[model samples]
Target chain A: MNWTLMWDSLPRLLAALPLTLQLVALALAFGAVLAFATALLRLSGNRVAVALTSAYTFVFRGTPLLVQIFLIYYGLSQIDLIRDSFLWPVLSQPMWCAILALALNTGAYTSEILRGAIETVPQEQVEAARACGMSRVRLFRRIVLPVAIRQMLPAYGNEVILMVKASSLASTITMMEITGVARRMIAQTFAVFEIFIVAGILYLLINFVATRLIKHAEWRTTPYLRARA
Target chain B: MLDLLDSGLTSGLHGWGPQLLSGTAMTIAVALSSFLLGLAFGAAGAAAKLSDSLVLRGLAELYTTAVRGVPELLVIYLLFFGGSGMIMAVAGIFGYGGLIELNAFSIGVAAVGLISGAYSTEVIRGAVKSVPYGQIEAARACGMGRWRILRRVLVPQTLRFALPGLGNVWQLTLKDTALISVTALAEIMRVAHTAAGSTRQSFLFYSVAALLYLALTTVSTTAFQQAERYASRGVRRA
Candidate 1:
C-alpha cells in the first residue's frame, strides 16, 4: 500500500463528502415522508390504497437501485412528454435524478420497516388509548408513532447506512460523490487499491459515526429498558 | 411504445429479445454461483465466529464488519482491479507469469459472494443459536459421534431456521449482479443499457429490464416461501 498516495487522495475524496451527505440527507428526508405515507396507506383499510402501496413497494423494492437510477437518469429523459413537462428541469439533472431514485428506493424499504413496526405496536395500548377517547391524531402521536419509532430505529439505522452506500451509485450518473472522485483519481493515477482503500475507509468512518449516533438515540429512547445499576 | 416493443422482440432491426434472454440466463448463473460461494464462506465464517478460539472469532468479526460497512460497489472495484495483481503474484510463485488475468464473471462471483457471505454469516450464526442446545446434548447422550450429532441434531435445525434469511441473501445476491455490469458483463442490466443506448429507446429497454428483475424477484420469493413451508413441516407454530 502506498501510504503517501492514499493520504494525499483523502482531501480530494473529502471534497466530495458534502455532495454525498447532501444526497443522503435529501433522499432520507424525502423517503421518510414517502415511506410514512405508504405505510399509512397500507394500513388505511381501503383496498385501493393497499393495492397501490403494495404495487409501489413491489416495483421499487424488487428491482436493483442501480437500474432505477439508470432508468430515471437516462430513461425518463427519453420521453418528449417528460422532457417538455414542468418537472423536466429537475429531472434533467443527474443530481436530482440520483436523489429521486435513491428516495424512491429507500421509500420502498423504509415503508416496509415502518409498516412492520406500526403493525407490531401493542394492540392493547392502542385499544386503551382509544377507550380513553383520545382523538385519532392524538392516539397516533401519543402512543403509536413513538413506540413505532423506537421499534423502527435499529432497522432504520440500517437503512440510513444503506442509503450512504447507495449514494455511491450516484457516481455512475456523473455525480462527483466520493466514489466518483476516487474513480477519477484511479483513472489518472492507476493506484486502484490505494484510492479505493482510502475511499472505503471514508465510508467506514461515516458508518462508524452513524452507528454510534443510532446507538445513542436508541439508548435515549428506551429509558424504561435501562438497568437500575 | 407498442412499436418500440415490437422492434425489441423482432429478429432484425433493433431486436434485443435474444440478447435480453441470454442476459437473464447469465444473471441467474451468476446469482446461483455467487449464492453457493456465499453459503460456503458463511459456513466457514460462522464456524470461526462460534469457535472457542478468540483469534478465529476476531478474524471473523473483522471480516463481517468490514464487508458490511463498506459499499458493495467499492468491494467489486477493489476485487476487479486488485484481484488481477494478486492473481499474477500467485502465478509468479508458480513460475508462470505471462500477464495473467481474472475474467469479469469470476470476479463478479467472487465479489458478490464475499458481500453475500458477510451477511449470511450473521444469518447462519443466528440460526445456529436458535437451534435448541438440549437437542445436541440428547444426541451426545444417545452415543452419536460429533459428525452424527452435527448431521442429526445441529445441521437440520440450523438449515430450517436459516432458510428464510438465506432466501433474503439470495435476493440481495441476485440484485447485486446488476452492479457487475460496470465490469462489462452482459447481464440483464448491461444488455438493456447497451440496447437502450444503441436503439435510443431508453424507456423501452430499461422498463423491460425492470420488469425482468421484478419477475425474477417475485418467482424466487414464492419459491422461498414454499421452501420455508416445506422446511417447517411437522413443526408446531404459535
Candidate 2:
C-alpha cells in the first residue's frame, strides 16, 4: 500500500493547508453575511424582494460550482467592459474569482437553511416579545434571531463542511490549494495514488476539525441541552 | 455593444446547438446511470450498516465518512487516472493481460455513484430505522418469513420515508456530474467549455449552460415532488 509514499507526501500536502483554510474562512464569512441578508429579504413580505432573492438562490443552487467558478473567471473575463472596468483588478485574479463563486454558491444554500430554521422558531414567542413593548428591531435582535441561529447551527455546520469540500474546486482555476498542490505533485512525481491519498487525509482532517467546532458551537448555543458541566 | 452581444448569441446558438443538445443528453444519461448504480450500492450499504456485525458496520461507516469527507473532484481524479490500472489488475487475476481502457462516462458514473451511494446509505438507513417495529412483529406473528416480511412490510415503508432524502441525493449526483467534465467527457459543461473557447463568446455559452442546468433541475425537482406525493399516498404528514 506504499505506506512510506503516503507518509513522505504528508508534509508536502500539509504545506498547502493554510491556503485551503484561508479560502474556507473567507468564503464562509462572506457567505454567512450574504445568507443572513438573503434570508431576511425572502421573509420580508415584499413580493419584489422575495422574487429577486429566490431567483438568486435558485440560480446559484441549481448550477454547479465549477460552472460558477468558470463563469466568474473565464466567462466574465471575456467581457470587454469587465476588462476595462475597475472591478477587473479583483475579478481577474483566479483566487478572487474562486472566492466570489464559492461565496455566492454557499450563500444561496445557507440562506435556504436559515430561512427554514427561522420559520421553525415559535411564532408565539415573537408575539410575546412584541407584546412586552419591544421595538421591532429589538424584538428580532433579542428574541427571533438568536433562536433562529441556534436552530440553524447544525444545518449551517453541514453547510460549512460542504463549503470546505467545495473549496477544492478552486484548484481547477489555478489556485494552489490542497487539491491543486496535490495535482501539481502528481504531475511532477507521477504518484497519483499516493499524493491523492495524502491529500484526502489532509482534507479529512480539516473536515473532522470543522465537525468538532460545529459540535462545540452547537453545545455552546444550546446550553439548556448540555449537562451542568 | 448590443450588436456585439446579439451577434455572439446567434452565432453560439446556431453554431453549437447540436453539440449542446447532445451534451445535455450525455449529462442526463450519466446522471441517471450513476443514480441507479448508487441505489444498488446504497441498498447494500444500508444492509451492511444494519447487519449485526461489527466489521460490516465499520466498513460501511468508513466508506460513507471517507467518501463524504473528501471532495468529489479528488474521487473523480482517482478513478479517472487509476481506473485503467485497477481494471487491468482485476483482469490479470483471471489470466487476461489485455489492456483495459475505460471511457470517461463509465468512470464518471462509478465515481459519482460511489459518492451518491454514501449519502443514500444514510438516507436508506434512517428510513429503515423509522419503520414501526410492531409492524414487523405482526408480520412475524403472521408466519411471514424474513424475506417475505422485508418485501411486504419494510420496503414499502422505507420507500415512503426515503423518497425525499433520495431526491436530494439525486440532485447532488446530477450536479456532481459537472465535476466529471474534468475527464474531458462531452457533457454539458464540456460542450459549453469548448464552444466558449472557440467562439470567444464565453458569457453566452456559460449562460446557456446555466439555463440548461436550471431546466434539468426544475424538471427533476417536479418529478421528485410527484414521486414523494405518490409514495406517501395514505400516510399523513405531521
Candidate 3:
C-alpha cells in the first residue's frame, strides 16, 4: 500500500470521471427510453411485436457485452453499405457506436425488469380504471405506468450499476472512458496496480452513490417504509 | 445482402469453421475445468464459513465479499498480469527460472477458476445453510463419524440444492471467458474478432460468434436443467 502513489493517482483518475459519467448517464437515459418501449412491445398482443422484442433481448443477453461492443464498433465499420449509408454519421464515431451498443444491451435487460414489474401490477387496478371510463392513455398514465415504475426501480437500480460496469467495455473500443484512461495511464507509467486500483476505486465511488440514490428512491416509493425509516 | 450472407456463411464454413470449432472446444474445457476447481474451493470455503469458529467465518466472508464486489473483468486483468509474476517469484524461491511460462491455457483456466470460486463460495454457503441442522445432529446421535456424516448426509443434499445456483455461475464463467480475449487467448470471441478484422466482414463474424455463444448456453442450460431434475428425483416438491 503505497500511500504516496495512491494519492498521486487519484487526480489523474478523477480527470477521466467526466467521460465515465458521460458513458454511464447517456447510456442509462437512452436505454431507459428504449426499454420502456421494448417492454410494452413485449407485452403487446401483436405476435410480431412480441417476437421482435423477444429476439432482440435473446440475442443481446445471450452474447457477451464485450462481443456486442466489438461487433457494433469494429464489426459495423466493416460493412460497405453501412459505411456509405446516411446512418454512417452516427456509426462513424466510436463514442456513438459504444453508446449505441451499451444502450441496446442495457435496454434488453431493463425491459425484462420492466416487463416483470408490469406483470406484477394488480389486474383489478386496470379494471377499475376501465370502469371509471378512463381512456387507455389515462389508464396507463394514472395507474399502470406509475405502479410499474415503482416496482421496477430496485431492479432498474441493479441494471444501472450493471451498466456502469458494462460501460468499461466501451473502453475497449477506443472510447477513453474511465477504464480506457486508466489503461492509457498504465501504458505510460507502467503502474498497472496503481492505475487499476485508482480506476476501480473510482467505479466503487460511483456505484456507492448510485446505490444510495436507489435506496432513497425505494424509500420514497414505499411510503410505508418511509414511516419505518 | 441475403445472397452476400449466404456466400459469407459458406465461405466462413470452409475457411474459418475449424478455428471456431477449436474455439468451442477450448471454451468448454475452460468452463469445465474452472467449474471443477471452483467446486473444490466453494465446498471448503462454505464449510469454513459455516463453522462455529470466528477465524474461519471471517476468512470466508473476506474471500466472498472482496471478490464479489470487484468487477470480473478487473479480476481477470489482475490475474493476467500478476499470475506470471507470482509464478516466477515462487520459482525463484525454489531456485529455478530462466523464464517459467504459465501458458495461455493455464492462465485462462486459473483466471476463470478464481472468478468461479468467488461466486461458488456464495452458492455453496447458501446451499449448506439450507440443510437443516437436525439432520446433522441426528447423524451425530447415531454415532456417525464426521466424515461419514459429511459424505453421506451433507454432500448429497448440498449438491442438489446448489445445482441451480452453480448453473448460473457456470453461465457467468462461460461468458467471462470471452473477456480473456484481451489476454490474446483465441477463444470464440477472439477468433471472431480476428476473422472480423482480417475479412472486414465484422457483422458476419460477430453474428456467428454470438450464435456460437447462444448455442453453447442453450446446450449447457438444457444439460443443467436435466441434471437438476435428476438430482431432485424422489424429493418432495412444494
Q: Estimate each model's TM-score.
A: 0.97, 0.97, 0.91
User: For every candidate structure, what is the RMSD over all alpha carbons to the true structure, in angstroms?
Assistant: 1.7, 1.5, 2.6
Candidate 3 CAPRI classification by DockQ: medium
lDDT of each: 0.93, 0.92, 0.84
Q: A74-94 in candidate 1: lDDT tens per residue?
A: 988877778899999899999
- B55-142, model 3: which lDDT tens digit per residue? 9999988777556555667666666766787788888999977687777778888878887897899899999889899999999999
Top-scoring candidate (lDDT):
1
Q: Where is model 1 chain A poorest over a 10-residue stretch in terms of lDDT?
A: A74-83
Q: Give candidate 2 regions above 4 Å deviation.
A: B1-5, B12-14, B236-238
Candidate 1 or 2, higher DockQ?
Answer: 1
Q: Give the Å error, residue B168, model 1.
A: 0.7
Q: Give the TM-score of candidate 3.
A: 0.91
Candidate 1: what is its chain A TM-score? 0.97
Error of 3 at B72 (Å): 2.8
The candidate, 1 or 3, that scores higher on lDDT is: 1
TM-score of 2: 0.97
- Evaluated against the true structure, the overall lDDT of model 2 is 0.92
Question: Model 2 over residues A1-229: C-alpha lDDT tens digits?
Answer: 6778778888878888999999999999999999999999999999999999999999999988888998899888977888999999999999899999999999999999999988998989998998899998999899989999999998988899899999999999899899888887777776778887889988899999999999998888898977787
- Which consecutive 10 residues in model 2 chain A have the weakest lDDT in total? A183-192
Candidates ranked by lDDT: 1, 2, 3
